[model samples]
Target: MSIEAGKPAGLRERKKLETRIALGWAAIRLTVERGFDAVRVEDIAAEAGVSPRTFNNYFSSKAEAVAARHLDRARMIAEELRARPASEPLWEAVANAVMARFGLTQETRGAGTSDQQWITGLRLMMTEPALQGEFMKAGALAEFELAAAVAERTGTDVERDLYPRLVAGAVWAAITVVTDHWLHADPPVAIVPLLRDALHQLAAGLPVP
Candidate 1:
């Protein structure tokens, strides 16, 4: 039978969401407590009160759980871009959307204790080979989503027009460079300013020397 239009999700959807969330949290908690390599999939599943097969349904690997929190940011930016004023320049639209989704500010800081844990998690992900690979995959997915958003905003065909993909790649590359530099900074540094600098560099369109 055909499903009803706009019907609220029934038992199955809620159960699935609960299961996914449990698995994600379990994976992240384990990874945070131990290094990524030290945490096993079976352990994560058990911690989440699910079977290994259920964990596999939600995430392919433990690395994905750590990165899951950031995945929604790309989709959020895409939605914001889609709603932006048409008069805004493409770069401005994208920049505003991206920053709105990820820009950190002092007002948002909580107990300083949590900040240290977040920084530690980031450092671990940066240093872990498996997690880095997963991070790259997540990045590629974000780029694809961004390209589609750009194409929609610019009235270009995402597949046939090369410009959308090119712009998306350039933007992703700029962010990647900034993030890599931040990870290796001797004294550590704030990401917001570095990301702002990267965005400005893109806006100025300076040729790479």
Candidate 2:
């Protein structure tokens, strides 16, 4: 795993994480400032204060770099799920794991970057062709890791069993819905409550009203 739960990152790992984050933020910022087609990988690297070689080592394309945080956060959620108490119910564990990483409270909102920046970057992804593809790819990778973690917790086969995949898909769908709603919300409602409600509805089997 790139980052371990409950453990401090080593200096080397910390440096790598910093570099990845810098390149990612640079990619998004540049893409936002210029049109996506106008922002080259070289420009992203330059903005991040790294060479093109260093940028290539971390990401294959500018789109991937811009979408890196989504992948990273999903991985963190999987790790958080694995670290949850074994005795907890699966849905509860899943919800807690998601919130641990994605809850948009004051502390979490200010960590590393501002909430407005994240929201703007995500809205941009919806319209950018290359970035939309990369965002979907990132989502698929996140679903795969999340399914594996759920499978591990439930002693199910990630490839053969439907349960883990279903759970992962549901979680990902919920995230997508919440983010989309939050992005286009006429008045801009908070996301955490929506996330919690969505997960709760899923946990409750989505009964008819």
Candidate 3:
């Protein structure tokens, strides 16, 4: 793993994490200010005070940098879910794990970046042909990692057990839809509550009155 195993990040790893984080924030801030097309790789690197080569080392494109936080959330939720007490119900475990990850994003709304900035950037991606495809590709890879974590928690084989894969996929899909709905709402909703509510609904078998 890039962060190493069973130990805190060493100096090198910490610096690398800082760099990637700086670059990601810079990329998002710039693109939010000037749209995706108007922003260049060199601009992201400059904003983060690095060379274009350094930016290339971290992310191949701007969209990947913008989406890095989303990818990290997927990894964090899976790891947290695996660490949740086995005595917890499956859906309960996933709900708590996801909520914890959602809290992480709160502090990261770094300077000059607001809900509107992120929403505008996301909306722009929908219309412009950008590196968002790469972002989705990264998200797909992260989904499988989440499935493996679920499998371990349940003592199920990822290769042989359909249950783990199905649950992981559905959970992520629900999160995506619910998150988009929250973002687009006129009075934006808090994601953590929405996430918890949605997971509870899924746990209840999607029942309606």
Candidate 4:
């Protein structure tokens, strides 16, 4: 779909979104079943019903496919922030948007056997060297996107100075802290509250509690 100035997206964009979702799910399922290291790019492409070339068009590597979920979350938050009321404070808008986008639902909280597998995969991602590198790259891309959004919202000059970068770095740092905590938390508490709390602390210019 075309995203012209001040215009809504079109059918093409919606179709592209569907394709991306299919590929993302296919990749996640494969990784969960066979473990990340065991999954091959050709197998993932076949599973997603796409050519290896098409898979490469969507993602650079198999690790990227598995990390797509997290990248999508950041993209969702950026989109939400961009759509928020113009008059709202930037930090409040960003925090609220992040929570709305990533907040867990009842099903996710009560996820049974699948939850264990999902958590295991996430733990593997955190500890595996290859996955960690992929994760960092995805995170850096997300930070740049987020910084652009914040610059637009706050009327800060993104290219000319360090303010925008500083804002982006602080936001990303807060998110990293929350993610690290969530990874280690035994009972798998909801991340929304942790993220919101962290953002709130940042907004207040105080240490995270």
Candidate 5:
């Protein structure tokens, strides 16, 4: 059934989303504190205050749980971008939509200088050799959302268009680079500005070859 305008999410949908988020955070926290190989699916389920069976409904493996956050955020960003005024510039709209989901702004990072929690989470996800497949798995999960948003911006069908795929790939490549640089920075540089600037550069054709 279609939800009417202004209708809040139904209880079941809310609960399912919350459970997925809780499980993802639990997986991140556990793996960060104890190392990836040390964590297990049962432990993640327990930390999220759910049973193994409940956890299984959301994710197939520990890797998938760890990677789920990006997928969730990606979907949110896609929706947000879709809602932006069509008159807005493509790169500006996409960047703002993404930062909105993270509670970030062009002038501020969400967490200020205290970056340990999330930076640690991202670093673990990016650096853990065992989780490399999971890292790519996360990126893959976000790919469709990016492609669809790009297609929408270009007034084209994602499934049939090359521009959408090309633009989406470029955006992801920029994001990957920014994320890596942010994780490796000695003082934990603010991500929001970096992300905004990266998008701006892309918007400008990245002329500094």
Candidate 6:
């Protein structure tokens, strides 16, 4: 197909992604404001400026909507990792890929640096009982994507090799633990430094202090 022919398809895909992201953010905001149990799919759709039927086309449940943001970000990370310089070490590439867009913005980063209300909302959303299972599913999806990227980068078979999956798991764990610490730190800390340190330690074999 020619460039002109592909333009409409690209635009359509972008619009769908934007809609999905809007719905997910709406779900998170509503859940934070009214508690997870009180929020409904219709409310999320309305908040996102879409209809309930449209929301249903994107996500089966409110929890899935909320988790979609994480899944999307993870996929982006995998893509970024794939694009990093070939000369860079795998850990460095992975870290840079993650730090490239993962929560660098004021709207999504942290309570201390960004909007407090949104951070508080995110904290509430993370702890919701109904959302836990969805988050796990999101994590699994994220890990799978990362593993595939790692396998490609290292020229390993993702299906048969253990290295890619292990690296992916470690990276995911670092992301999870560091983000949790940043979220709950007594004196709030910047997420970027914490994430960088976590990756550094992992790359350095977690040497004794």
TM-score against native, each model:
0.74, 0.85, 0.87, 0.84, 0.85, 0.88
- How much does candidate 2 score in TM-score? 0.85
Alpha carbon lDDT at 126, candidate 2: 74
In order, the Cα lDDT scores of the candidates are 0.73, 0.86, 0.78, 0.75, 0.77, 0.83
Candidate 5 worst ten-residue window by lDDT? 104-113
Better of 3 and 6 by lDDT: 6
The best candidate in terms of TM-score:
6
Off by over 4 Å in 5: 1-8, 103-121
Ranking by TM-score: 6, 3, 2, 5, 4, 1
lDDT of 2 by residue, 57-96 (tens): 9998888998887888899899999999999999999999
Which residue pairs in model 5 clash with each other? none
TM-score of 3: 0.87
All-Cα superposition RMSD per candidate:
5.2, 3.1, 2.3, 3.1, 4.2, 4.2
Ranking by lDDT: 2, 6, 3, 5, 4, 1
TM-score of 5: 0.85
Model 6 residue 42 CA deviation (Å) reads 1.4
Residue lDDT tens for model 3, 76-144 = 788788779889999899888888776535355555567776776666754555656766776787778
Model 5 C-alpha lDDT per residue in residues 1-209, reported as the tens digit of each score: 11222357898878888898889878876776677888999999998999999999988899888877767777777777777888998888887887787532323223332457667766766678757887787787687777887797779999988888887788778778887888889887987788888888888999886
Which runs of model 4 end up more than 4 angstroms from their true locations? 1-6, 46-49, 103-113
Clashing pairs in 3: none
Give the C-alpha lDDT of model 6: 0.83
Question: Ten consecutive residues with minimal summed lDDT in candidate 1?
Answer: 104-113
Model 4 lDDT tens row, 1-209: 11332456688777776666567666766676667788888888897678888888888888787777667767777788888999898889988888878743434223443655666766765776777788788888888777877888888877886877788889888888997888779888767788888889989997545
lDDT of 1 by residue, 72-191 (tens): 456567777777888999888888877777743333322332644656765785788877777778788878888888998888988999988988888788778877777667687888
In candidate 3, stretches whose alpha carbon ends up further than 4 angstroms from where it belongs are 1-7, 103-107
TM-score of 1: 0.74
- The per-residue C-alpha lDDT of model 2 at residue 183 equals 89
Worst 10 residues of 2 by lDDT: 103-112
